[model samples]
Target: MIGKLSMGAGAVGAISYCYYDKKATDGNGEKAVRGELLYSNEVFITKLPNTHLHLQYLAAQYHQVAQLNTKTEKFIWHQTFNFPPGENVSNETMVKIACDFAREFGFEHNQYLVFRHRDKPHEHFHIIANRINANGQNTATDRKNYERIQLFCREMENKYGLQVTKSKQKSYAQSSSVQADKLRKLIDKHLPTCQTLSELSIALKKQDVIMYLGRGISFTDRNSGVTFKGSALSRHYSRSQIESRLGKSLVLQAPNSKQIAISDQSGSKNLNTVIKSKFPSQKESLPVSKMISEHNNATETRKDLAKINESLRSVKNRKVKRRIN
Candidate 1:
C-alpha cells in the first residue's frame, strides 16, 4: 500500500469530486466524480439529499474553523491510501484503515469523508478531513509527518495482513551499485527465455527478483529489496522498449470497474464485489496503473517497429535493403 497527504484551502471542490451523484465531466470527457462515499461523518442529513448546497455548507463550516488558525492557510487535509494490485481489500476494511490513521494521526474529531475510487486498475480510497477540528484546534501537524506515516503504514499493514510497502525501505541497506549489478545480471540471464512482458516478470520471480511494472519496469531484489528503474540499467530495458523487443502488441483496454457516483446507487453487484475481492493470478500481471502509458514514446516506437516488421515480410520476394533507425 501507499500513503499520500496533501492540504488545500478549498473543501467543496474536493468533497464534490469524491461524493457527488451527478456526473461532472473532466478535460478528458470522463466523469470527474468517479467514486462513491464509502462512509461520511457529517455530510448526511435524514431527509435532505446530498446536493451541491450541502457540499458547500460543509466546506463553509470547515473554512469557518480554518479562521481559528489563521497561520494554517492550507486548512483542508486530503489523504489517500492506495492498495497494490491483486490485494483485494473490502470497503469496510478501507474505511476502517482510514479511520484508524485519522485517530492515530490526531484527526479523529475532525469532520471527514472516505470515498472508494474504482476508476483505476488498483483500488484506492481518499480521506478529506478538516485540518482545524470543531474544537478550534489544529489537528494536523506537518512536522515529522512523513516519518510518522512510514511507521504507521507499516503497523497498519502488519495489523490487517495487507501488502507491506515498507519492505523496500527495510531491505534497502545495501549499496545501490551492488543492487543494480544484481538486477542487471538477472535481466541478462532471463530476458532471452521470456516472450511477453508479463512472462518476463514471472520468469524473474523464480530467481527471486520481484518485477513491478508501472509507467516503466522496475525490479526489486528479493534479497536486498532495493528497487531500480529499468531505464537505470539501460533505456532499452523500459516497459515499452522491452515489449518491442519481445514483439508484444499493445492492448488498450478500458478499466473494467464502472464508476459509481452515489453509494446508494445500484450497479452490477458481482462486478463491484470482484473489483474488491478478486486478485490477479501469479503468472499473469499488470503494471501499476495510476496511468496506463507512462512510456508513450517507447510504446509508439514498438508499434512502428511492428508495422515495419510486417511490411518487410510482405516484400520478401525482392531483396529490400531497409535500414531501421
Candidate 2:
C-alpha cells in the first residue's frame, strides 16, 4: 500500500496530461464536453460526454455547491493497486470497485475508469475531475481525498475477502545507496580469491545477494546495495557457467564462531595484500559492480535533485518576471 501524490503539472505531468488529452479526442468528440474524462488509452474513451456539466448540475440539484472566483484547472488523479495473487477480480471489476468506493465517499458526481495494461502484470486505474463545485469554487483534493480513498480500498478488501498489502513504511529507491555500501564491503572481501566469475557469485550468494539478470546481471543486497553485471566479474564467463559454480549446486556452510574468525582474517589479509601489491600507476583493479552501482545511483540522485530544485527556482523567477513585465 504505497501512495504518492503529484501535482497535475510537473515532472510527472506528462502521463496525466496524456490521459486527459486522449479522452478529449476519443471517437465521440461531440460528447467529450459533457462529463470529465476519467481514463483513456489514446485510442479508446471510457466516460460519457457532458459528465462534468452533469456533475455540476447534480451539485446544484443537491445544493452542495462551493463558491470559487476562477475556473479550476482540470486535474487527474491516479491510483495503482497491487492486488494480491489468487484474486479473481478482472480489470472491469476493479474499476467498478473504485467507482463504488468514490460514491460511498460522497463523490457521487465523479467519473472513474479501470484500465488494463497488457504490458504489465498489475491492474491499475485512474480518476479525473474538475475540482469545481456547482458554485464554481475549487474543491480541496488533499489529505482528506487520500484518507477517503484508503478507507474505501480497505473496505473493498474486507467485503470481497481480497488480500490487501500492508502499508509500505519505506521506499526502496531512496535507501538503495545504503544497501550499495554494504555490498561494496562484501565484494571487496571476496574479490581476491574469486579467480572465476562463478566463485565471485558463490561468495556473493553466501552473503544473501539476489542476482537479477536482464540486459546485464544485477546482484542486489536486500539490505543495502546492488552490483551491476560486468562490474565485478568478466562478461567472458557465460551465465550458465557462473550459475553452475554459484547456484543450487553448491552447499553453503553457515559461518560458525571459528569460521567467522578464520574468514575475517583471510578476507582482511587478502584485501591488504591485494591493495599493497598494486603499483600507484599500474594498478590492475577489476571492476566491482557493487561499488559502480552505488556511485552511479548517488550521482543520479544528486543530478535529479538539482534539476528539481532548479525547476522550482525557475517557476518562482517566472512569477517575479511577470510582475516586472
Candidate 3:
C-alpha cells in the first residue's frame, strides 16, 4: 500500500474536492463525488440533508473556534491510502482500516470523514480531518508527522495483510524509470557518506544495486536490468561533481594485492606510493604486451558479477510469487 498526507489552509476547497464527483457534469453524467459516504464521525450535531453544505458548515465552525489572526492556518489534514490493483475490499472494511489508521496516527482527537473512490482500478480512500483538535488547538503537521503516517501504514499493512509498497531505496535499486526523481533523492542520501569506490559499491550492493567502477560511473538495478548514470540522475551526482568529493579514492583495489594496481600489478612495490602519486597514468598503464590480457580479465569479472546478480534476482522473484499466491 502507498499513502500520502497533505495539509492545507482552506476546508471548503478541500472538502468539496474530496466529495465532488468530477464526472457528473451536465455535458457528461459523471459523479460529483465518485465514492459513497462510507463513514463520518463528529462532523455535525444533526443529520444534515446536504453533504456538501454539512462539511462546509463544520469547517466554518472549526474556523470560528480557531479564531486566529491570520486566515491562512493549514487546518485541513488530508490523507489518501491506495491499495494494489485487484484487491477486492469492501467499503465498510475500507472505512474501518482508515479509521484504525487515523487512530494509530494520532487523529483520534480530530473530526474526520472517510470516502472510498471506485472510479479508479486501485482501491483507495480519502480521509478529510480538521487539524484543529477538539480543544481548538492546531495540531502540528511536519516532516516528522509524515514519517509517523508511514509507520502507521506499515502497521496497518501487516495487521490487515495488505500489499506492501516498495521503499524508495528498493524501488530505485530496481531502476524503475518511473521513479527517477525518487532515485535521485536516495543517491543524494547515501553518496555523501561513502568515502571510497569499494565502500560505495558495498553500500549500494546492500541496497540490491550494483555500482560499476569503470571510467564512467553508473548504477545498475540488479532486479530490473535498468541502469542510470550519475550525470543523468542529478548535477550533484554527476561524475565530475562526485569525483571532486570522493574521486581521489575511486580506484578499486585488487584483492590480495598489497600494491595499488588497475588492470596490471605484477611488479608494484608499494600500493601506498601509487595512491599517493595521485593516479599517475604512466605508472598505472599496462605494458603494451600485457594490455590485452588485463582488459579481458576485467571484462570477465564484470560478466561473472552480472550472471550472479541475475541468478539471485530470479530466486527472489520466485519467492515473492510463491508468497503472494
| Best model number under TM-score | 3
lDDT of 2 at 217: 49
True-vs-predicted CA distance for residue 270, candidate 2, Å: 60
Q: Kindly give the stretch of ten consecutive residues in candidate 2 with the minimal lDDT sum.
A: 269-278
Over 4 Å off, model 3: 26-31, 45-53, 68-72, 167-325
Candidate 1 vs candidate 2, lDDT winner = 1
Q: List the residue pairs that clash in candidate 3.
A: 20-32, 20-33, 21-31, 21-32, 21-33, 23-30, 23-31, 24-30, 24-31, 260-271
Instruction: Identify the candidate with maximal lDDT.
Output: 1
What is the full ranking by TM-score, best candidate first? 3, 1, 2
Consecutive 10-residue window with the lowest summed lDDT within model 1: 268-277
Error of 1 at 122 (Å): 0.5
Cα deviation of 243 in candidate 1 (Å)?
48
Q: What's the CA error at residue 166 for candidate 3, in Å?
A: 2.3
lDDT of each: 0.69, 0.46, 0.66
